[model samples]
Every structure is written in C-alpha cells, then in structure tokens.
Target chain A: MIKFSDKQLAIPKLMRPVYLVTAGQSKFDRAFPDKRTEELCIDALTQAAEMINVTPAELKSYIHTCYYGHFADHFGDQLLGEAVIHDRLGLDPLGNCGVKTGGATGGTTLWEGVKAVASGYSNCVLSMGWERMDEVPTDEGNFLISCAADKDWESPLGHIYTGYYAVMAQKYWKVFGKEEDSFRRTLAEIAVKHHGYARMNPYAQSPMKITIEDVLNSPVVAYPLRALDCCLMSVGAACAIICDEATAIKLTKNSPHKPLRIWVTAGSHTLRPADRRDMAIPLLPNETADQYKDLGKKFPGGERYPGFTGFLAARMAAYYAYNQVGIKDPTADLDVIELHDAFTISDVQTYEDIGIRPYGYGRDYVESGDCYHMNPKTGKPGKLPSNLSGGLIGCMHSVGATGIMQVFEIACHIWNRWAEIHGDDKLWKKFDRKKPADWTDLQVKGAKRALAISHAGVGSHVTATILMDPDKLIKKDA
Target chain B: MSMFGQVHVKNGQYKIKGDFHELTPNMPIRNSDDGWKLMGVTNPRDMTYIHSYGGESIFFESLSKGKLMATRCDNKKCESKGSIYQPFRIFCPDCLSKMTVIDMTDIAKKTAKIHTFMVCERSGAFNILKRPIKFINIEFDGVCTILMSYLAVGEPEIGMRVVPIFQKLDPTYTILDMAWVPEKTKSNHLPKGFSF
Candidate 1:
C-alpha cells in the first residue's frame, strides 16, 4: 500500500540504491567451545572489513550506524566486542548497538542497514550478527524462549514450544483432512535437499550429506517435524556492507577484484501474530489470486496464479519487493533466491508461496528437479540456486544473524567470489556435472536477480528484499 | 426417666470425708433486673425489636409453594422497593424500603461467562502429586455483578460459559453448585417450558 515510487516505476528515492559490495562470515560450527560471543563477532567484523579494503579507522567515519543481532543473554549487545572494535580499530561511529527479535534478528538487521544507505543517512553502514548458544546448557536456553509464552494460561497448562507448534500442525491436518505421513514426507524431502546443498557450503554447521531415507528414519521431535527437519544451534557470525552507488563504485575501484552490487527494490514489515484476523489460514494467502482480486485487478496474464505458503511472511515480503521492482514472474525473472529456512518444512512451503510451484504442488516442484541447484529452468546451469550457502538449516542460527547471512551469500555468489573459496573443505561443492541426477539446471540465461525473505515468529513479523543485477538497471535507465 | 447426682466433701479437712449430700431439683436459671443474669436470655416485652416477629419467618413463608413474598418498607428512597433476594426481604439494605417479590426460578439455570482465571499448581499439605486447580471469576446472565468460585476444569480459557445447579440440602438449608462444560443442549431432565 505504501508505494515508494510511481512515475519512475522503480525503487523510490526514499529507498535509494545500495550494493552489498562485501560480505564475510566466520566459520559456522560447534567447534568453538571456549570462544565467547565478543570474540566471534570481532572475528566476523574483521573479516568483512578486510574484504572491503577499508581500515577500521576509515570505516568508523563512513559507517552511520551498526546493528548487532544475538539472542543469548549477555551476548545480545556484545558489550565487550563493541568496546574492543572501537578501541582496537580506533574507529568510533555515530551509532552502534544491537537488537533481538528471535530467529529473524539477522535478516532484520540487514534490512535496517539497507534502509540506512537507501535513506541517504550514511554512505557506508555495517550490520553484524552472531550467537554463542552452544556455550549454555540446552535446558536453560530452552527456558529463555519458553518464558515468552503466556504464563497464566498456556505455560501453566503444560504447553511448551514443541506442543504449541504441534497443536497448530494437528489443526492443519484436521482441517485439510490430510494424512500425517504426507506432511512428514514434505519436511523430510526439504531437509534432504538442504543437507545435499550444505555439502557445497564451507560455513555450514552440519555439512554432511543426507538422503531422504536418512531424513525419514531420523527421530521425530514434534510429530511431523523429525530431528532432521529442525535446525541446529551453533556459533557463528555474518556481516555485510551497504553503500550508495557512487560510494560502491569508489570502493570496488580501489579493490583487488570486482564487487557485487545488490540493488534493493522494496522492503517492508507487516502485522504481528496477535493482530492477525485468522490464525488457521496460511500466513500469506495466495497473493496473485486473493490479494489481486480484492484490488479488483489482474496481472498482465488473465490467469489467477497461486502465491507462496510455507515461509508465508518471507514469501509475501519477497512479492512486495518483486512488484515494486517491476518483476511480474519470479520463475522467469529472478536468477537466484536466498530465503530463510528456519525448518525444512518452511523451505518447501516457501517454494509454493513464492510461486515456484502451483498450489499444493510444491512437492512436485522438488521431485521434478526444475528448482534443483544446477537446473537449467532459467537457462543458466548451476546458476539459479536457492540457499546456496546452506541457509539456516546448514548454518548456525544466532536468531538475528541468520537473515543477514542470506543477503551475504547472494552477494558472494553474484560476485563470482564464492566458487573461488570452494577449495576450503568447510565450503560445500553443490554443482557436480559427473553426477547429473544430483544437479538440475535452472535455465537462467542472463545475469542474476536475487530475492531474500526474513520472518520473526513471536510477533509473526515478515520482511522481504529484492536485488537485481546492476547491469539490468543500467540498461533500463529508468 | 430422669437422672441427677451431687458430690459432697468436708470444707477444712483433707483426711476426713463427710456424709453424702441430698440431691434436690434445681430451678432453671433466669435473668433478673435486680440480680445476677444467666449466660443467654433476652426479655420479650422490653427488647427493642428491629421488626415485628409474627406469622412465619420469610424463608419458611416462601416454601409454602406458590406464594411470592417479600419484606416491605415505607422509606421514600426505595427504588423498586429495594432489590429482591431469593427468600424475599421487605426492606432494601440501602434505603430500608419495602420491595415486591418476583419469581426468578424460570431464569435461574442459565449460563455465565468466565472473566479471568488463575491456575494453582501447588495446594497446601499436598506434595509429590500435582493436581491443577483453577480459580475463576464469572458474570452470570442478566446479573450486573460477578461471582468467584473454584473452577472445575483443569485449565480455564477466558470466555468459557458455565451453568448453575441448585440442590436442596434440607428443609432449612440449600446449596448452590456451578459447573462449566463445552456448550451443548440443556438436558431433558431440566424443568420443562423454562428457557435457558
């Protein structure tokens, strides 16, 4: 409803064009047993700053703001890290702080950084996120999230997080009249695919390859959600740099290699859980059909298309970005996608919600191999990938840091710098021509147009960002 | 048949005992204006009575079946002759005015909505066993005020509805019990022709 531009038919001036330029992350795993949150954050910040060819002193003057994302108690602010970064680097910016909003914290911070550069507030801004969850006992960590539930009603009645989600899952089954195995298989297939992709990501927390059989055999935690269907809590940090076109060109000109320019199209945050009118309905209804019909109009084609479902919030956010940036067909328009996969079930759901498949046909989309890592559906073999950096399932989830990592991965892939680091065993090799069955061609013929979606569960907050190739924008000249 | 006894002992001697005392009929104790008064007694004529005590008590008077009765007062501020209670009072507690009694048995078994509830995980003197208890506040239908009770359900949602059930313990005493279940049709055993 809030249109940023009308005449230009592109991103509004309020939401300026900014490029990712540089993205760096520390190794993601449970291997860092003794490492504190501050240590992990500084390591990640140092890596990202070094890649941009900017000294700490130079970064301080240009960075208008900094946001740190972490859910762990003391680590949420990373007080010690903030002090060390400022003192050691001798760079004190105007603003620097951290925030938390559960698992969506990472993506939220990245969006904030994007807003900063787009709004002309700062030429260069840094957003960093890290979590040291493995340091604490599992019971204590579980208690932190559980404490958020309504104490008087739900909590006292023996309802925990698993039970809460299980009840919703049960309601879904009851209403749809679907078998439990059907839902279980959907989660298993997604987990297996992400696990397979993790083999190509060096920073994945659990990089070992897995099969559908393995996923099906995994221990069930909450009925349909098996052990493999869920994500692991590991320790790591991801950071990104956002700057205007002039600053981006200047920074890349001085660099040793070409930089990745991420042109953000649209971004927004939507309603919380308590405000929702209907709880039983999917988070985002089929936008192309339901939402467009309500507006009394249709797209260029007369067909009433299905919208994304699984990662409802993220998928909706992505749709807004695509619409704002003049992208009508995602399958034919975008080259790659990096979405939050909090659970394997969410990944399959996202495929459906994002219009990658027809309604109730997400499973077929995965089985058909068109959306596979190296598929030629978009005409480029092994180019149009989803969650190429292993996503949240493969990477460590420091709640707020996961979303920023999605943007960072897309930036690295577009810059062609990602494959150079494939030498590291920590990085997984996703595209293997020898095993053609394991790889699918996306068929993307031109440069890449990337999309990212972020979601916050407690309040049901969702945000989406779209990045198009700078060359395309240059050609359009609008 | 009647039985009575009396004990006797010498006043100043510890070693010697006296003969048995005579057992006589003692007069009932009474309160006198000029002498010592007994524990619980009131004068009939001189007592300042708040109201006339004649015919039958209001509670007993109403149990005769079809009679709709209430206490009456002459106060000018009496609104609707003061609100009526089940036993029916003649005067209002605020205005002290007489009120007309109206039959409310037709609507007595209706439902109420729960306002709030608290779950008690621990009960005094009980340990090693966790018995969940809920304390709820409910607003009855057509009643402006709310009542508090121990909710029978283990967990109470905010807007659950409940029905009141009444049982007569004796000719002089009656008990009221309320229970909440998922909404359903009233049982056939309920009084016929009364809408809930």
Candidate 2:
C-alpha cells in the first residue's frame, strides 16, 4: 500500500493574502468559426475590465506578469500559443508563462497567478485561459483528447476518453449505486439540472430544457453515460485578475465588485488509472474514522479507497484548501460551488471527494436536492447550490478555460451581478444568443463563500479554488 | 504512389526511408449562406511518428510470441519489493530500482478477473478496435495495480474470470497485440490472428 509522510500531507499555505479583483468569460459554444481564439480571449478580458468599471488598458497596467492557460497545442496547431496571445494583448516584454494540466489548466493558471501575488513578486497578475477545439472535427478532437491518456497503453485501446470514465461508472454503478434504476435516474437528474441552469446563463452552451427521461434516452456514448451525460467540446475563453491586498483595493476603488479573498490549492495523481494503489482514506474535518469502518460491509466491493470510484486528487486538493481557509464543513460553511463535472458520474464522484457528502452517499446530495439552486423537494434555497453556471456539462469544457469559467461563475454570484450580467438583453444579443423568456436570476442571495474544483485526466491533476468575501472570513488569520 | 514511412535504429542512430508525410493541397472553406464568402482553409497533414519502446520493448516483443511478460521489483531495500507490474515498468516506483522481467502467462490465466469494465459504442478517429468495445480492467491476485485491456469475447462483468490472448499472427507490436476473453472461451471462438 502507498503511504505519505507528514511533510507530504501538510496543509498548503500562501505567504500572503491574494484577492480576486474581477473575472470574466466569453460566450461559450461548440465552435467559433468566425472569431479567432484571441478575439474570444480579448472579449473575456474586456468584460472583466467592464465589471470593474475600467478599460482593458487600465487593467492591463496592473498586471505585472501573466499566466496563460491553453491546453492542446496540437489542437490549435500552434506551439507557444501563449507568446502569440501575449503579443496580441499588447503585454509585450512582460514575464509570462503557460500552464497546461489537461482539464485543470485554467485552475492551475489561477494557482500560478495567486502564488505570484502571494509571493510579493507581483502586485497584480492576469490569469487567462482559452481553448480552440473547433479547429478539428469531433472525432479527431476526441482522438486528440485521448492523447492526454497514456498514449501507448490507454489511447490505442479505443482512442476515446469516454471509455476510461465508463469503467469507473461501471464500478460505481455496481458498488455504490447497487445497480438500482433509481440511481441511474439520479445521475440523469444532474444532467437535467445543469442543462436547466444553462438556460439562465447567456454565455452557456447546450441550454436544453431537457428532462431526466431525455437524458436517459440520449444516445449512449459509453454505457451508463449518454450524449447528454457528457460535457460539451467547446471553444471559448475565461479570465481572472488576481492581486495582492493593496493592489486589489486600488483596482476595485470605484467598481461595484468587491475584492474577494482567493486561495488556490492543487493536487495530482498518476496519469494512468492502472497505476492507482490502495491507500488509507484521508479523513476530512467533517469525517471521522469510525464512520467508515464498516464501508466494505455496508457496500460490498467498496473496500478500496479511491479505486476507480473516487478522485483522490480532488480529495487532496480540497483537503489542503479547506485547511488553508478553515472550512469545517463544505455544506454548512460554503454558500455556492462549481465542480468539474467532466461527466455526470465524475460530478457525483466529486461531491464525495470534496466532502459535500460522505463517501458512498453522493447520490443523496442530488436526491435530497441540496445541489439545486432551489431544492425541488422544498421551495427554500438549497443548503449549498452547485453549478448554477451550468457547469461543464451544460456549459463549455473549453479545457484551459473551463476552471476559470467556473471561478467567473461563482464570482458573479458573490459579486451580486449574476442577474445584471446574465439577464442583460444587450449582452445576450452581443453573443448572438436569444435570451430565454423565462430566464430566471440564479444569483444566490448574499453568497459569502464559494468553491470551484478544476480537474484533469481521470484524476491526474485537480485544483480547488476557494473565494470568500473578505468581510465574512471563516478564520481571522486566514 | 508513395510508400509508408519505415524506420530502424542501428548503432545509436535512426536509419529512415520512404515518405514520412503526405502533403495535400489546402482547400478554401466558404460559407454558402454568406454569398460564398471565404472563411478558412483546410490544412490536411498525414505524418507517421517514430516512437521508441526502449527498455519495455521486451514486453511488446513477448506478446507476439504468445507470452505475457511482467516486471517485478526485486530491490530488497524497497518498501514494495516483489510487487509485480503488468503494464510493465522499467523501474520500481517506490525505490526507482530497475525491475526484473518475468513471464506471468500462467498467473494471468489462473488469477485474472475483471475489476471493472465498460462497453464503448463509439471511438475516436484512427481507432481500429471493433464497435461496441468491451473494455475491461483485470486484476490478478498478487498484482498491486490493475491492467487495462479489451475483452475479445462475451459481455464483461465485475469479478468475471478472464484469460489473456495474444495476436501472434501479424502482431502490431503494440499493447493492442494483447487482449482477454472469458475463462471458458473456446479456442475456435477467438478473434482471427489471436491465439491462447
């Protein structure tokens, strides 16, 4: 069995406080045939500046260095795309670097930006992420994505990434789900909810008013995972401006947006799922060792910790982020969350990994409707609303930009501009998307704290980004 | 007609011949709805990559000989000494010591069982696997990690016993050269070019 030293398991800490001054995202879609990737990136940066009542040039002045996230150099057919984008943004001669951690590229970019500010190296930093996936057809795109796997071993098997997740789904279905039809329907509910939430976000893609039945009947990509159950292959961009305390206050001087405190922590595992070794379940603050003593007995064949059914990288990321920010219980402490729902099953797996629910009971989080903006069972708000931005499922999996988009989404609610940004008819028309007649304001009222999980390949890399209103600090020192 | 690229290593250098890439003319992509306006051009590229298996070449070569080769950590100082790896590793992960290669054909035949499985209905471009691929993750009694492979016959279920089969004839000298079938599968039912 694998073991960890105290040093390896130590909680991560930043040297100083970092703040998210503002964030923005471009309209997400399957393909942006007319627009170039730089245009989408510029669109995101412009919106970020507008949110803070500043020009793009004004915001650019504050950025000392830049962190660009653009996964799949092969897809764009451009090596050193960051240099191209950096030159286009007119941020010439500044120290800049690119971050590529598969699906977690966006979050990893933010992690670097936050560190740069926290280390006192930069007063302010720009974290930008984008993906150009529409350059190739869907099947070729899938093949390219599969290259992220262990090329020699896993990629050649099917050249399809869905099959990798499908095996995990099959295991979870038998062990935790117990092969019940209701469990399958519960998975479908997540698709319905994310897609339903997409209807409210003007920038979101695949905004279908689909039902659980529609999801269940959708064409199967891999068994137990259908077309609707998968995340969209998208082209778009998202960006965040991270700054130190003084710079943050300076940048948001006249803006309505608040300088929310931000902390980004990351964790990683073996790229190949075959290499996963058994280990002791690292208990979160909300969990006790006694509660899981009977896990194997309760659910047969579920004895293994993080054996295909769980994301240990996500758990470790949350472990460090929670300790850093003093989050005792996510459901009770956090107001909103955006998980990397790369697939419907991965979404449920994340609920368990992040300690929103205990392991083996992730289905309850959805069945109880605690994940909804408004619980279907009750008219009251959910205990902790999740993925009101539609997540990757209904929105975009613009690889490099996905995690940044999630941060932008949660930031919107905390900034109290969700309705203003999402409901504006001008913004809707700007993207050439029709605003739904019944587009409801999904801003969580008085949201104080939020979390976003950005995950990569199987569970290779994951970053947990926590944003809390500075006034509502959970821990005084934090 | 141009021949496909071929490469061989001799004396620490690559000896290459034939065409490595086929160049095609770029075609303009126009929008018919917008008065046939020019939009973009298709850049078609076909290139073959030369990859070296290096230390693990023995594993691939063994597959064509109907042998299953695995690596075991023989480092006595290592914490995970004696742990066998199916997707053969050149060195022990725990101690970073070069491992010893051993044939595990009998062990796989007797102990291999599906740990988890998936049935994929579609595949990405350049995939040669048949439709409705029954992907299986097999675990052996003594193996610390699971091995991912495809089941050549019957539906897959967790805990179902399976045995390895090799593409001994016209082997591609890749991981695809190995597959698994049900424990009781008949020799005649095996896919062509594969043998027990």
Candidate 3:
C-alpha cells in the first residue's frame, strides 16, 4: 500500500516529471505590421533559449514534442505551423500539433506542457500561443469570433460578442441587487490598476495610464460596457519550456545564472457546452468546488486557497489549483495572481468566483487596496496588481493568445525579474517609494507559490495552473 | 507477325493508299454581343448621355413645358458620380450619395462657373474623336455643388462660364443639342421666359 505524505502529494510531479526551464514572450499589441506570426514565435523562442544560455538548435535536441496554439485570420492553421518549423526555425519538430480553445488557448497550452512532461512522453516540450487578429478588417475579424458560438441560434439574431457579456452583466445586476456603478467602478479600478502595471511592462500593449473617469466616459461598446471595459485586440506570442526534474537541475547547473524555477502543481479543465448549460446560473460551480476540494486534499494544511478566477471557467480551474496546492487563506497565502480580464466586470465577479473575496465583498477588496498596490501594510503602488500586465483590458484580447499572455506575466512576477525594468518611470510614484529599495522585497514574502487562471466563454472551457518554487518540494529526487 | 508501311507521293503530295481519307471544308461562325447584356446588377441610369444638336445638354423641354432629363456622361471615371443630367445631382458611386444638384436651364445657358476642366485624348462611344471632349467642373449661380459638363469651345480653362443651347424638337418642346459655349454667345443664353 502506498502512503502519500501531504508535501509529496501537494506538488505532483508530471508523470514525465516536467519543469519550467525557460519562458519567453513577444510584445503584445493590437497589431504588428513588420512581424508575422512565425517571426513572433521565433523571436520569443530565441529569447527564451538565450535566457537559459541555449541556442534554438540546442533546445531542439531536448524537445521530444511541440504543441502550438494559434488563432490567425484565415488559413492560419496550415500556414502558421509550417512557417514556424520550416521557414523560421529551419528544423522539423518530431511532433507538432495545434489546439484552439477560444480565449483559454494560453492556459490550456501551458496545461498541455505540464501534461506532456508529467506523463513521461517527453522530458522537454515547448508550448506556444500566437495571434495576429488586427491584420484583418474589424467586421470580418468579429465574424471569426462569432463562428465560435452556436451559429444556429446566436448568429441569426445579430448577437455581438460584447452583447453576450452585457446580458450577463444585466442578469448579475438583477440577481445580486448590485448597483450598475458597483460593477462599473470595480472594472474601472481593475483597468486603472492593470494599465498602471502595464506601464512597467515593456511587452504590454496599450500601456497608457487610464483613470476611472476615462473608463466611465469611454464610448459604449455595449450598455454598461464602455470602450475601456472591453479588452483590446492585439498580436503577440508567448512560449514556455517544460522539462523533467533531472534535466532542469542539469540545465541549471550548466547555467547557474538562470532566473527562478517554478513547477506546475495542479491543473484542471472543464468544458460546458453553451446549448446544454444554464447561462443565468454561474457555469461550472460544482466542478469548480470539486477542484478546490481536490487541491485541498492534496495539500492538507495551508493558510489560504491561494486561488484566483477571472472568468467562470477560470473559477473552476482555480478551485482545482487551490485544492491541489493546499491554499488555506488565499488573501494571505498567495503572493501574486494573474487573471483574464476579458472585460471589466469579469474582474469583480472573478474575485468572488475564485474565492478571493466573499460574494458581496469583492468591492471592498478593491476599495481597501488589499488586492492592488496601494495596501498600506504592503506599501506598494497600483490597483489589485492582479492583471498588472495591463491584462486583456489594456493589452487587448487576441482570442488564442490572450490567456497565455496572462500566464507569462504572472510567471515573470514569480521569477522576480518583472521589476528590473519596471522602476524607471513616474508610474512608480504610485508605489510611493520615497526611498528606492529592492522591489522584490515588497512582493509578498514567502510568495513561492502563485496561481494563473484562464477560460473561454463561448464554449465555457476553463483551465488553471499552479506554479511553485521547486525548493519547496517535500520529497527530493533520489 | 509484323506489319510493314510504305510511303508514296502523287501529284507532288503524299497520299495514303491503304486507308483513304477525305477532307472537309471549315465554316466560319458569327458571334454576337446581344446575350451579354448587363442584368441583376445596379448601374448609373442618371449618367448615360443623350447626343443631340443642342450641344450635349442633359434636359429637354417637354410638351407640357416641364423639363425632362437624363444622364449624359459615359466615361468610366465619371460613372462613380453618374452623369449629371436633369435632377442635376452630383452622385458619388463609391459612397453612393447625391453630392450636389443644379437646374438644367442654368447648365445649358452656360451660367455655370468652371471650377476645373480636363481635356481628354482617349475617344470611344463616350467621346467624339474629331472634336476634343472638354470636361468641365462647373458650379451654377446659387448652387453649392458643382456639375461636370462638356465644353464645345475655345480651350477649356478654370473660371470659364459657359451656357447651354437647345434645339426645338417640336412646336412646344426642345431637345438637348450641343456643348457648353461662352456666356457671351447669343445662342447659349437662356430664353426670357425660362424661370430655372
């Protein structure tokens, strides 16, 4: 009989025993006129390789397989994959395929990387998501997103993507008796915070500073959804490398000057078909609860859940991640969180859904400065600092690449390299740093554990990933 | 078993004796453009021109003394705004909007100021080869939008006000007959009784 220790059970090694050896990304923006999809992938891959002191050819030797996530305008599947392998990299991968799960593509891709290493099929794998949505005309681009929904019922009525979310916002208002300004104010705070953080990130798109007033007055894409409330459309690529423990240690020794080492603790996915599910009731509530229970069971006694959710699907995923990671008190245990803010309202609602704040108290979390940078005790600057990388709001949404971009920013924060270039501007004044000290110290101490959540609305696909510092692993590899 | 072939020539031409062949004459077939008529598609009905001795005017005096009109320009470039005839409206084909309109009598009498003018070298069904087609951008008195008309005359230039002349088609009606001429031309002036 096998007896599982709490520590050993908490962070399950990938069946293949994978480690995030290196991660890299290209700039996120509404469009990239000079760079194509393949170019962006190559640029990110090259940077990731260099960060770990390896060349593309060198990294290819360890890659047993590669999975890509791309959502281009047209003929993207056939052309983008081949273009990356043959034209850009000049090497044919042993195995290469693609996945599309709407906005959750990024999180799903990371989960795939985790699964690949854990399952032992490959000691090393490369996962990437890239999109170039801005190249197409706006009307035609919108048509592509509409294709993801139930065409028979939704498309015929001229139902726009924003309108779908607007209906949900309206329903939430009626059910919770929440004021419209409450949701709007929460969204504005989120956008302002993320935009503030985005000013620090070089790769973020639309890093301009925005205020709640700006969010309120912006043009309305849908009722109660001003322009600022909606995410921007952008072009970008994010990549991560997952390898086994032995390989990770070997690589680290080979290049001792590498960044932080984070491991995937838990991951869960839930698919809710729009036609079969109840739209009014929050989707995947049961599945999300189960995920949290499972994570808790894995990590017996933690202070908080350390879980966060940005969308309905993200809520379900966060449940599982929190369960596996054993987060007892999320507000105190978790160091940093990155969530999908496809719209402003999502941020407020996600706070409750992710179990971060109680159902009605999400607003208090925002106003109190507990989630953002203005916490008196933390003495940091910015809003919740949740979607600090401008999130999908300031960065805009590139369906396939949006989710992964959130993960990449979170990973950067955990790795502690996020603030290296973030302190040079007037934006840092928000931090109220009269005397400049190392920014990393301001990060939640003992914040070796972090959570990333992503989801898709059309089909309700949710994915969550928990990353932890490898030093905390209970059982050392023999 | 094997097969053998032999070649022979008769009357300075090679002929096959084993198998005889006959020649047939080819006939020429005529093709017509009648089946190619444009249909199911929208075209500029207000842009088609009517040629007459009245110097290429777009309107005519009806038997009832009211003005009748049609489009006059056949140029592909001018199709975007359709030819300005009676209703004298400036239409943009791209945006499909009426940019401006003016009275037909004012155009015929050359009471319009030339905003711009262009001389063309190409001629087809749309132009008379012997006579240069001078396209003028003319703005009538009291009208905001300008009209493009053909100038019959002395080298077309900006600021040139040309009047239109009409030829009587019957006792009570007239047809558009001829190009815009200098305002000073006696035949180009509007009749005393004409109101618009």
Candidate 4:
C-alpha cells in the first residue's frame, strides 16, 4: 500500500512542502448517459491512480482524508455520499465527508484537500468531485439547477442562473456590445474558440468545432444567451492526490509522476450575490440597507450597482491568490488560466473582475481574440492561454466536477512540456490552432504560473488559486 | 527538483451564503402545491410559507386590508432615530435594537417609482407562467430599502411612477397577492384623493 509518514508540513512559507503528485478526470463528455454515480467516481479515481503508476487498490492504506464535492445530492439519490463513495472505492477507513457550494463545489473541495495536506491532517488525501447530471431530462436538470437561485426572489421570478446571466448580458450589451446584437457575436465567438480548443482535449464534451456563423444561428435559451452560450450537462468526475513533501519525494523516485510541489499559494470565498447592495458592486453588498450607507463611507465608489453576482467575489479571490504568488499583475504575471465561463458575459466580465483588464474594457479584450491560444511560433502561448480543457462551456459542466477539471488541466499543461510525446514536429503541427498539447508557445514563454478561478454557490461563492512550477519558482529564487 | 519547499499555515473564515430556503428575498411568501406545472413538468411542491416570516404576520395582514406597515427602532438612544422600513428582520440592521411597528395610514396614496426591472419569460405562483412576466425592483416613498414585486402592468423603464394594487389570493393570502399597476386608477383598496 502507498505509505509515507513524517512531521506535518507547514505551508506558504514552505518550511515543509506539500505537492500535487498527480491529478486526473474521467471523460468530460455527454457520452456517459447511464453511468452510475459510483461508476463515474470510480472511473475518475482509477484514472488518478493510473496517473501515479498505481492501481486504485494500492491507495487504500495511506489515504487519510477523503474530500468529495457533490452539488446535487437530490439528483444522485444518496446521502452520506462521501462515506458511501469512499467505502465503494475502499478508502472508507479514512475520515471522509462531503462539502459543496452550488457551482464552486469542485473548487471548494480542492481547497479542502489543500487544508488536509497543509494543516498536517493527512499525508495523502484523495480529493474528488463529480455529479450524475445526465440521468435527468434537460428541463428537469434546468429546474434542479434553478434550485441554486434564491427560491424566494430569484427562482419564483424565473431568474435562474441563465436568466440571471441573461439580464447581465442585456446590461453588458447596453454597455459593451459592439453592433446590432454584438453581445451575441461576442458570445458566439467565445463558443467557437472554446469548442475549437475542446477538439484536442480527450475528456471534453461537445468537442465538435463550430463556426461563429453556426453559434449565431443557434436558438436562444435566454434572450441574448443562445443555447451554445451555456455549458454541457455531462456525467463526469475528477480527482487529485495531494501529499506532503515526504510522500512526494519518495514517489517521484523512479516514477514518471513529477511532483509539482503544492505550489498553490492563495484562495478566497464570499456569500450570495443578492447580499450585495447593487448588482454592479462585485462583493457582498453588506447584509442590510444601512450597511450599504456605511460601505459607501468606508469604500467609496460612484453609484454602486450590481453587475454580475460574483464579480467582486472572483476579484477578491484573485487578489488574495495573486498576493500569495507575489504576482503584481494578472495579465502579465500569470502564464495560463482556466476560468469559469458559466456564460459568455460572465467570462468577459471576469477579464476585468480578475484585474486582467480594467473594468469596462473587457469587451475590447474578448473581441481582440486575446483569450485564444496564439501559436508558440507567433505572439506568445504563455501569454495566458485560458480554458484549454474546454472550460465549463466546451469541457462539460458537471457542477462539482468543473473546478477539479480545471485544476487537472493546469497540471496537464504544466507537465506537458516534459511529456516528450509532443516534441516531434509532425505530431505537434497537426493543428494550426492551439489544441491540448503543452502548446509550445506557453511553455517557451515561461513563468509556468497558472491561475484557476471558479464562481458558484448560487452565484456568490468564488475561489482563485495560483500555482507555480516548482522548477520555475526554485530557479527564480536561485 | 529538490523536495524542499515552504508551506504556509493560516486559519481562514469563509462566509458562505446561509441556508437559502429562508434567504429568499424578504417578502410575505406563500407557496402552491405544484410549481413546475407551468414549465410543462410534474413537480409536486408543498405549500411552504415562511409563516409570518420575520415575525411580520401582522404586516401581511395589513397588506390585505390596504394598509402599509413597517418597523422602526423605537429606542431614542438608537442611532436610527426610529426610521421605518420593511422589517424582513426583527432587529435593527444598523443598531440591532428591537423594533416597533409603524402603520402608514396613508399607505394607499404613497407613490412608488420603478427602479430597475427585467421582463422574465416565466415567473408566478407556479413555475408555468408563460406571458413575459415583468419583475420590477421599486423604490417606495419613505422606504430606505428597495422593494421587489411583479409590475403587473406597463412597459418598464428605470424611473416610472406606479401605484400598488392588491388582490386576495385564495387559501393562502400572502404579500405576493399584491402587484403594482400603472397609473392611479380606481381600486377596491384606493386611498383618499386617488383618481385616474
């Protein structure tokens, strides 16, 4: 059985290091129509084992904490779910429990794993997140997801997540949309780019490449939010094995798994969107009306209004994560990104929210094709290639699974440069556009720093994490 | 790569949105048996009510009688100075002082204007409403916080004065039984000096 024990590791200061030995995910596609939740859980777990050159059974003796993310306990037909899944995977002897926040469930679970390792709670923790959304019909699924909205205010009014975003899309168009329905064009363009990126990601759902023309013609689900502007309802799971420095060093010996020392440096979280005074102000609006008056005195901005729910939540997370990594500027300091694209408007707004661009300038950045991967030979791949694993849009959104999937893709891209398979020109030149490889441009351009941002929990919960390549961080220090 | 690296430690407090069932926007709420019926689906729901939510049963009772009620911090020492507003809460948000009820006897004549609004394709007692329901966030006279409701009438704009209209919903008459209408028209609940 996999085993390594030592004094608990301290974090951030790096007195004792913890590392992400490996990460994995099941096929991120709508292909698994009838898979059981346990089957999908196992599907992802076994793959995570394979990533580290071990079988699922070999992980039994060492797993200490089992953190699982499950957004739809109602849909899954099970309770005490983490216990049940851990039992099925034979990791039950360890303490296990589930944690969730509507959309940020996966990201939150990942943070739990980080705590387990950093807090000296566990040496090897299995962090998994999955959802069985494919079992339900589309309308029912939509309704179930709608339960994430404020049932009293948002749900009754049919201001479901899409509807919420659709209203934001309306305002965004009123502000930034280029021409007649230019906001629609921006969303169509984002869809085309992500679908194109998904083409190479083996685990992606709806990897079919589409043209802007096709996205433009698609039926609208919400005004301005066409069907393609949303994400896929895929049955998928993702897992990562985070271990302390002691276990990582031993495993890396004679193993293909490169220990990317737990380089994740920062994180942040906040409450529901409606708590904010106005939609435009990103963070919690303070709980009461009087508090907004105090907030106005404490943090002044002209005419605060709510724009999108998690803009400030995401901004705060990014701020904290950036601070952890000593990143001065996100657009310039970070190399790769995987952001939640619940809606194209959310994506465009996130560009400014996360400080990549100043507020109100997101439409310009998105329309410039700056988010797409530029060939390694041309502009710069590491110039912050985002959502390469197709993101929530092209990669498939299994709610709790999306955040972990983003982390998995970051690990994949970080290690892709060393994989040797894509080193050959013939195989590498297969696509002119950036596909799933460690796109040479990204690796060559360098810091190898990546950031993954997630927003969920009824449009308020958000988490931002910054990871550094152990080599890059070390080399720079030396 | 060397196996040595620093890991930092810090305790964190995460303020997540609390249980949302009760967090629905503070309103006099009542539910029906099946909400998903309008969505062309079978959803059997219970008649869940916040039950004089915020201990304001008297407030909802006032709405049916065409009276507007609010709460204010009664303590003179309290910084709020007895300013009144919808108390989906029991204590003062500013001073945490227990509040007393205030009846707006002229509630019927108080004018409210549309603040911001959205025309949702569906929203009603049941999830099945299909007629482009208009939900508006409105600012009422003498109220500090914005109130929300369906603008049962009018093409929406940022600032449009609208009058309040209430109808008795059978079985479970809640605040949702009231909606906003355009113009000052004759109504069963009409206040003094109100005319078309």
Error of 2 at B152 (Å): 0.5
| Consecutive 10-residue window with the lowest summed lDDT within model 4 chain A | A1-10
lDDT, model 4: 0.62
- Residues B9-110, candidate 4, lDDT per residue (tens digit)? 347433333232322232232234555232222233332232224466666776676565667767788655556664233566656776788775355246
Question: Fraction of true inter-chain Cα contacts (below 8 Å) kept per model?
Answer: 0.00, 0.80, 0.00, 0.06
TM-score of chain A of each: 0.78, 0.99, 0.80, 0.82
Which portions of model 3 show Cα errors greater than 4 Å?
Answer: A1-13, A72-87, A254-312, A376-384, A421-446, A473-478, B1-196
The candidate, 1 or 3, that scores higher on DockQ is: 1
> Which one wins on TM-score?
2
* Two-chain DockQ for model 3: 0.01
Q: Write the per-residue lDDT of candidate 1 for residues B1-196, one digit (tens) a residue.
A: 3223323335733332333333344444344653655533211221111222233244333433323233333455644322333223444544554544554433333556654444543222211113444444454444322333334433555557654333222221111122233245355533222122
* Structural similarity to truth (TM-score) of each candidate: 0.61, 0.99, 0.59, 0.75
Q: What is the C-alpha lDDT profile of model 1 across A112-133, one tens digit per residue?
A: 7777887888888788777766
What's model 3's lDDT at A178? 40
CAPRI verdict on model 2? high
* lDDT, model 1: 0.51
User: Which candidate should be chosen as best, given lDDT against the real structure?
Assistant: 2
TM-score (chain A) of candidate 3? 0.80
The digit string of per-residue lDDT tens for model 3 on A1-478 reads 1122465334344443456777767766665544567777887787678667787788767777777777543524245553464346554646766766777777777777778777788778788778777545565455556555444323322224554455445434433324456656766777787766666556667666677898888876655566777777777787887788777766656553333344332232222111111122222322333343343233322112211122435544555555545555566556677777777666666676677765444566677777764564467653334666667876556666666666666665666656542453543453233323423222433456566666675326667666666665423441
TM-score of B chain for each model?
0.37, 0.98, 0.40, 0.61
Candidate 3 global TM-score: 0.59
